[model samples]
Target: MVDADQTFVIVGGGLAGAKAAETLRAEGFTGRVILISDERDHPYERPPLSKGYLLGKEERDSVFVHEPAWYAQNDIELHLGQFVDRIDRAAKTVRYGDDGTLVRYDKLLLVTGAEPRRLDIPGTGLAGVHHLRRLAHAERLKGVLTALGRDNGHLVIAGAGWIGLEVAAAAREYGAEVTVIDPEPTPLHHVLGPELGGVFAELHREHGVRFRFGRRLTEIVGQDGMVLAVRTDDGEEHPAHDVLAAIGAAPRTGLAEAAGLEIADRAHGGGIVVDERLRTCDPDIYAAGDVANFPLALFGTELRVEHWANALNGGPAAARSMLGQDVTYDRIPYFFTDQYDLGMEYSGWAPPGSYDQVVIRGDAGKREFIAFWLSQGRVLAGMNVNVWDVTEGIQKLIRTRTQVDPEALANPHVPLDTLTS
Candidate 1:
């Protein structure tokens, strides 16, 4: 076991790192704790950046996980706005910043998180083109997007995953003439599957957002270092005054990879490989959140969920593992998203194309339903859309792996508790 008097270092300024720090303190660790972030702001949540904060509904301070004073009060050292260049695993230290400062650690947790996948097309480097990943990025976008909406100006978004869809909804709500471009026939087709993915596409269509499907991005057209349009392989040009590239995220695994840590599968978003307890190949090193491709015991799969709930749950679990506690991070995956009037919560892992049937309750047209994806009558995954307060029941049904009647699952007259009980 690492000595309690030695410093336990955590790298990354996002929710995962912040929560890990909080866990260390809460678990009565008397050791020195150092939380480092590349961004100047304290650790904060990223979910609100695309929705509420982008829409001007939430304040900047509200997004932060902890106020600036919390670090000082807890005796945790803070290093902000500095690049973490390297991890010298043999020396048991992390070397960072232009100054080459070395910080020794008894144990280290790398919650480095992921970066927005870049568009390698022309005009991406032009002015008025943006990527919505950080608070600073969202802060810059909010005013411009709102102004674009007010002026009826055009905004083109590349890719149609969660970020792309949510930003389209938000930019449209803020009054920008929004158009989403993706090569896939339907948005979120890979994960949500074609049927459910079409529902989100229709939702955006109903809200007056345009989409360009079956077309891959060729180049971003620009004039005077500013975006004017986006060109796709289909030879179609989309007019735009501003552009957002939300193609998805790639894990920031350079530091770990350079340090010779076992990396996870690149086909599955490539992250540092960690066991169920979030321990890496190096016993003194650990990982969690978006960067840890840990085993999902629930579905007998290896997946890293880049969602708020995973970080919130995985951080504490990793901390417990680091403390020499007998722990297995077996929590089922869960995530929720808000777009316009629609809200949703999803739980459980549907192993890659393994669901045998999809049973839905309530009205899809009315946008109120609970969708269950099952394999041979066993619930594999479940999602509740615009339905209030049933996540716990849904998660329980998933955890218990209960086989149920599709008729019972689809019946609104039958309470969810009845099926699970």
Candidate 2:
């Protein structure tokens, strides 16, 4: 059923959009594939922006998805530094760039991704304030970290989320003093809950990172267009040479909203609503990556995952669906983080209230353990810290929703595969 005349338009140049174009060709579509991105750089993965790249351990070219010649060799139309302003759904045309070049598509895909949520406080426009969503941001931040390290300056981070903590670790590696401020009692409170959040707090503290908990950043005090200090609601000022706003990211659904596509409410994590096949309200259009909110039958809930894994797999799934292939995307939510000496991978979704108890195996004191969240003896989620090659077994336990004895689950002697069996 391949249509030679059909054109598939992908909006956004992030990993999801780029991978979708790759999938289309690999699936033998042979249709006109056009990818438009506002960023001048080619498609790239974002994990390195906070990890190896920020620490200057990896080269700038490592983040890109493919070589520049790949697109040209594949006969895919690559439009860089062009923003698609509007989508005329009735006519199936997208108007993009300054001259408003209109391109018609047989099927449209939105991988528009997300933007970093900005700090509303004053002095955010100062030269030393930064956000880490794009490669450009990381490039600027790398130089800022290096300068801070060279001058023995201080960095004040506004949030203790993944981005904040990762950058804090990277800054420490560069020998910069770091202070993390968060309203929560501990870092990663929402994701790991208080039970395991303390582990990360301890890990950072051991590395000499300061934590200013139970407080909000009221304002960024700057002088002469450079950050001087940060003030907390408690009326205390901390000296800072640079500030990082890692508050989180908001999905970019403006074009989809304008196109009249169904958008999800905040309770379900605001994003464009999509079905199992990743098809939006308008059948001819579909969505993937951080922008799409699709159902996870395993959790019996709708989730809009903003992690790299979601975008990595979701893009290909959406492409197959768009190609009229039978597709049902129900992969378990997975993400990993590397900070200082601790490397962890988490599988399944278990937010604060979803699980009743957290069972831990191995040694939490040694920073090598697997923590499992359970609800009435059913495995909801699992996180393995510095414990290698157990992701497959942990994922199986969650997918099967296996009921196990708490003692056995907590005993490292008992194999994970045995519990599932």
Candidate 3:
């Protein structure tokens, strides 16, 4: 039976918050649970926002992570369209804007995820300039694309991250001329390293997408409140009918900091600090998903991964810890992207200059290959394009820390399954 006196209040109705609430119930916590979400709609998956949903291939209803009736059946109090104004840790109360209602909690979970980092350059507030971080943003962008049609539209995307690449793919599918600009030498170079990033760069180029590497957007020129062109740092102006900013996201740690919790700076310099159990400095409050920089046992470093798998898996780990269960949030980070006709999967983490060896399996020219990164004889990371099974096998190898003869891994004839044992 749930303790009637204990009430678990979860803030931010995104995937992390919703999953935490569900896990609490699954773990036999019968306490009164209240889930507060800023969005009017129930929690939904966000990965599709830059892909299928933006392209109109998937409906909004299909993106929902869970149904409203499911929450009701689970006895979860749903507080939709509510913004948490402040958190009082001493009083254990949350001030929110739900018809001026105040809610208190015995235990609190902060799953408030990050928002898109916008370019502060000129003309950013123009009608044609946008950012893709929320459902509404994607919907608005889709509407513009549909209205403009395919014939004579141009989309200039800022940043070469997953979102920018996915949007570039979608825009090209709509027959729009797409150009992606980034300061990095290649897309995802910081995470995937330069060689694998070069493969991706080539992949996008073959799809008729233009790339402006080592370039940064200095200003957005607008006429009558609609963006007309983008001025780069090199003083060159590129005409663009639409502009989408997908630079990256910063952690939403205002609530945690307001609660007087010690917020440590990320090793990579922009995320929040949390322990292995996803607990912040204040033990009573826990943070997960994109907002928390949890320690990665595999890398022996604290990192913040904004991937779908991390949010889904880490949320429950935070909830279990809150329930007094000893659980550690450590897993090989994984993320996937759909570009053109190919699906790419990435597992584990290895920043640039960390990996000592890289082995390419299969054929990159054929667009089906697996790239493996090894550090000190341990599999540190793997990237697969149209070769998911190979990536899965690599994941197991990384998890088990299995040592393999470097030459055997590079040979195409060697079965990946052989590494499982």
Highest-TM-score candidate: 2
- TM-scores, all models, native as reference: 0.98, 0.99, 0.96
Descending-lDDT candidate ranking: 2, 1, 3
Candidate 1 residues 7-89, lDDT tens each?
89998988988888988889888899998889988899999999888888998889999988999998889899988889999
Deviation of model 2 at 172, angstroms: 0.4
Report every candidate's CA lDDT. Answer: 0.89, 0.96, 0.85
* Rank by TM-score (best first): 2, 1, 3
Model 3: lDDT equals: 0.85
lDDT-wise, the better of 1 and 2 is: 2
TM-score of 2: 0.99
Q: Lowest lDDT 10-mer window, candidate 2?
A: 218-227
Residues 253-294, candidate 3: write the lDDT tens digits.
787787777666744644567788887777778888888887
Pairing residues by index, what is the TM-score of model 3? 0.96
lDDT of 1 at 56: 89
Q: Count the backbone clashes (under 3 Å) in each candidate.
A: 2, 0, 0
Report the Cα lDDT for candidate 1: 0.89
Which tens-of-lDDT digit does each residue in 251-362 have in candidate 2? 9999999999999998889999999999999999999999999999999999999999999999999999999999999999999999988999999999999999999999
Name the TM-score of candidate 1.
Answer: 0.98
**Count of clashes in candidate 2:** 0
